[model samples]
Target: MTAGMPAEKSMNFGPSARRLLARLSPQRGQVLAVAALAVLSVACTVIGPKILGRATDVIFTGLLGKQFPAGMTHDQAVAAVRASGNANVADMLARMDVVPGRGIDFTALRNVLLVVLALYVVASLLMWLQGYLLNGVVQATILRLRADVEDKLNRLPLPYFDGQPRGELLSRVTNDIDNISQTLSQTLSQLLTSLLSVIGVLTMMFVISPLLAVVALVAIPLSVLVTRLIAKRSQRQFVAQWTHTGALNGQIEEAYTGHELVKVFGRQQEVQAAFAAKNEELFRASFGAQFVSGIIMPSMMFIGNLSYVAIAVVGGLRVASGAMSLGDVQAFIQYSRQFTQPLTQVASMANLLQSGVASAERVFAVLDAAEQSPEPARPARVTDRHGRVEFEHVSFRYQPDKPLIEDLSLVADPGHTVAIVGPTGAGKTTLVNLVMRFYELDAGRITLDGVDITTMRRDELRGEIGMVLQDTWLFGGTIRDNIAYGNPNATEEQILAAARATFVDRFVRSLPDGYDTVIDEEGSNVSAGERQLITIARAFLADPSLLILDEATSSVDTRTEVLLQRAMAALREDRTSFVIAHRLSTIRDADLILVMEQGRIVEQGTHQELLAAGGAYARLYHAQFSAAAVDLDEAAAAGAGQVPAGVGPRAGGPRPRIPAS
Candidate 1:
């Protein structure tokens, strides 16, 4: 199964194709206009061949009539032929309205030629107009479809993104949509024109000669059979081609995004091999699809040629027996070619149609995904806007069978700093995520200042909170622009103040462009520590009543971290803050400390109290400090002389002194 795909795939071609066509419902008026114009244009085109046949007849009759005696009347000429024992020839000549005693009449022939030319000219104009209108209809339909897909994306929950590959999702939104546009643009008007031409030509063929028409009709079943056989096989290949396309895109995106890591680990060959495998899969699928569908046009043309040959033989015999006129026979031959031409065109378009519907199915998959539950229609508001948060017997699980957090309860009063510490996979981050309502609870509820969080709109609840995560994200823009993202309407003074408070202004001032420095798409222009600082500055600018810092200062050096800690101390003065950190020293001054293990709080108290209690928090703190003490002693023994006990590492060393908490 493709990443993030629904359990049931919409692989049926008929339903998917019909759904694609349904998108054009909004442009019904334009579609109807295009259809009407196609009918008129085909009517004119079908009439042109018949009128041109008259011109051929006029020239032929005049040439034959002039060969007879100069003064012979029309009846005398026919009687002369019959007297000569050529009764069939006499009957054929009787059907022609020819003046036997005269040479070719150029005036009547000119009139017939003029009418044929006029019919073709009108046909061309109508075709051009229909194409213009259909372009609008196709573009409008695609525009609306794109909008719906974008809207659907915003409504999807975070877990949907967690399971989906970024590159695969991008392919559906961009590449798939582009393919659909091209298919509709190239196929819509042409399909309509081809179908109408087939109908108009078939009508004219039967009118001219039904026996010959029946001979021409023999190819229809053969054509249909060949098309069905080829299309059935090629459709599967087309689906595989698109699926491989998305997989290849996903691999390429992951490789490029982690190019530095790949180089660091010396895994370039492995990455290349994976890429080659995916590329080969895509190539094979594409070749199979094209080669199979490619056979259809020639197959159709061959069948039509057989019918053409049979029609020519039968029409000739009928003309000789005087059952059909020379002019009508000429028209019937033209009609046969016209009838077969449209079938060939449709056959040639099979590959595009198949590929287009495949892309449509992928796009519809995104649209049909289950969305996040809707927000409350009449949402409750936090009137006083205090930062107090409470979790009342909250229970949740990522999977239905595996319970992660069960009946957990906690509370942080307004203007208090609550610090959480735990080993990996202990639900530390999950607790903070619950406060943000990133996922809904399986049972019980969470509230902010006594209002149920679910009852409040997500945007409104998130607006009053600021977060700085462990992984910093920065877009391509000036540093000033990135900082301003946290508060779009913030003044220049406010932005600069936040930067100074977070110690970002210190290093930024030493750079060439300072605040105006442009970051690359990956933010490679700056160090990781600087990137983290920028995110911190952004959160500071937001200045929310609630703040959550998840290892926010992990990337910075000791001196910079010390400066940031002082700034954070002032920032946390009157706001409720939830700080999750592995570095115990950073949270020693927090108002309350909660040590968690396996999704439950094993201990909670002030730092000194927890250490004296000799519980999980004490073990964690002693373990961290003992490791630091051992490292310092090892460095001293390796260097000059064994240093005295309880001393620090060499000055300006990589490791910082372990302060007493």
Candidate 2:
């Protein structure tokens, strides 16, 4: 269930590779243009060597003709060489179309050279155009892929985010996608050009001299063997490299996020040790992948050299025997080089392709994940927002085998304050979360104003409620901006009113920037109490019909809590509110008090009525007051110059308490 975790199973290269290429399908027109250009470029390049070979023939024939006796016909030159007992030279002379007593024909040579130069120029221009178009195609494909991933993130359920490490998920979205872009940018055009060159060059080699062409073919099997061996080994390393990269990023992010806690707990060494281990793993993986794939190019070149040596030796014998002309031999050698060069290029590109595909697989896994259930096609509307919430036989569990809440039911009537008090893991927070639809119930349904919450659009249901949690969240923005986040269209007067109502304005005026004060990235510039007040102010601005406060006053001082209580009482005038708190004094005035134990309401009544019943609520009420009484007694004794045994002045004073209502 952990997101972006490396799969324990081996990578399926074929399917993933095919899927990666399939992403290019939308750019079919651009791809086709690139391919056509590649074909034309390769064709021009292929023909260049043959045309130059003709120029070589013109020069060679003219040079040899000058060595013959002046006025001697081509037939006489061959006959004279035969009579001179040089039969090999006679055969060579017979094959060559040489004019006796003639020197290098500069004009013909110049004209052939011009044609070769023109072919090369046209080929270069076409190749450049091909590269430009291919770049656009690749960029467009990656752009679509990035958009898809971003959309997928929004559709994912909360549980998906809960299970995923932030850094690992970021690595998948940002790092993995970037890797794919680089891979395509480096390989696509080169791969196409190399493939086309191979085909064109091979065809020309065969046409010029089939025997030498056959010799060059010997390198193909050897090259394939080398490439396959290296690519197979490197591919696993590439997968490992990216996997470890994600793991290392997760570790680093976790470490940095909790850096303050690490120092406070003196666990810096432990965190560093863990980081080093993951870093080492990533290093080893990257090195192995690079080193293995690095072998392909040199190994291919070695195989090509072997083929080149064989072709050269054989072509020389054929030329000397007059089975092939000097010009054809020269052209065949050039074609052989062209053929092996592309093969080597292809072999070298295997590793890059594999690395890119590895990243593509990771990105695709995110896109392929299961999303939250679709919203209702015909969503039900809550016409009257009275804020009456009812849980009808609701059952839920984080795990299938271990139920947390089963068949639990409750109702919070409009304009009433419902306070829930419980021990840890008693499902106090879970109750409010269900109301907000953060999670789906396993059975039964929650209704808002007599309408099933499931039938309403999630956003529409949440829009009617406001929430404040124990862990305050403040982004890096001015105080005014943070407050306005609750209601984006709130006027300046409303923002100031909410801030003053929640006691935020009192502190804001004391700061140099007042309401314009900027919160840092961590919001560490503000005290915990100040941050909590800001969140409360934000909720106030929302002015929702239903409010859920989870330990909203836990971080504030006793005086501030008392002030906030008065502010909240006024705010809750015509709205329903669910307040989860451990402080019994804060909830003594609630219209209904629910004492929950093990996900069931063990006691339900007004605070004083529950106390009269002397059940779970009574025990919880007494437990909190008893602890505070004990601390107060100790502090009182110390003030009277009578310190308890083994106690010192630094033992601290009585804990802050909210006055009983």
Best by TM-score: 1
Per-residue lDDT tens digits of candidate 2, residues 1-661?
Answer: 2443444554778999889989999999999999999999999999998988898889889989999878999999999989999999889889999999999989999999989899999999999999999989989999999999999998888888888888888999999999999989898888888998898898898888888888999889878887988888888888888988998898899889889999999999999999898888889989998999999999988998899899889999998898988898889889888999999988888888888888998898899988988899999988988889898999988889887888998899998999999999999998998888878899999998999989989889888999999999998999999999999999999999999999999999999989999997678989999999999999999989899999999999999999999999899977899999998889999999988888888889998899999998999888987987876777677567777765563557563343432
Worst 10 residues of 1 by lDDT: 1-10
| Worst ten in a row by lDDT for model 2 | 1-10
Which lDDT value does model 2 have at 218?
Answer: 83
lDDT of candidate 2 at residue 519, scale 0 to 100 = 96
Tell me the TM-score of each prediction against the true structure: 0.93, 0.92
lDDT of candidate model 2 versus the reference: 0.89
| Model 1 / residue 392 / CA error / Å | 0.4
Q: What's each prediction's clash count?
A: 0, 0
Off by over 4 Å in 2: 1-8, 628-661
lDDT of 1 by residue, 1-661 (tens): 3662221332588999999999999999999999999999999999988888888888879988887988788899999999999999888888888787677779989999899889889999999999999999999988999999999998998888888888889999999999999999999888989999999998898888778888998999999999999998898888888888888899999999999999999999999999999899889989999999999999999999999999889988887787888888889888989999999999999999999999999999899999988999999988887788898998889899988888888889988899999999898998888888888889989888889999999998888889999999998999999999999999999999999999899989999999999997678989999999999999999988799999998998889999998898888766789999999998998899999998888899999999999999999999998996777556656454554554455664544433333
Q: List ranges where model 1 is wrong by over 4 Å.
A: 1-10, 628-661
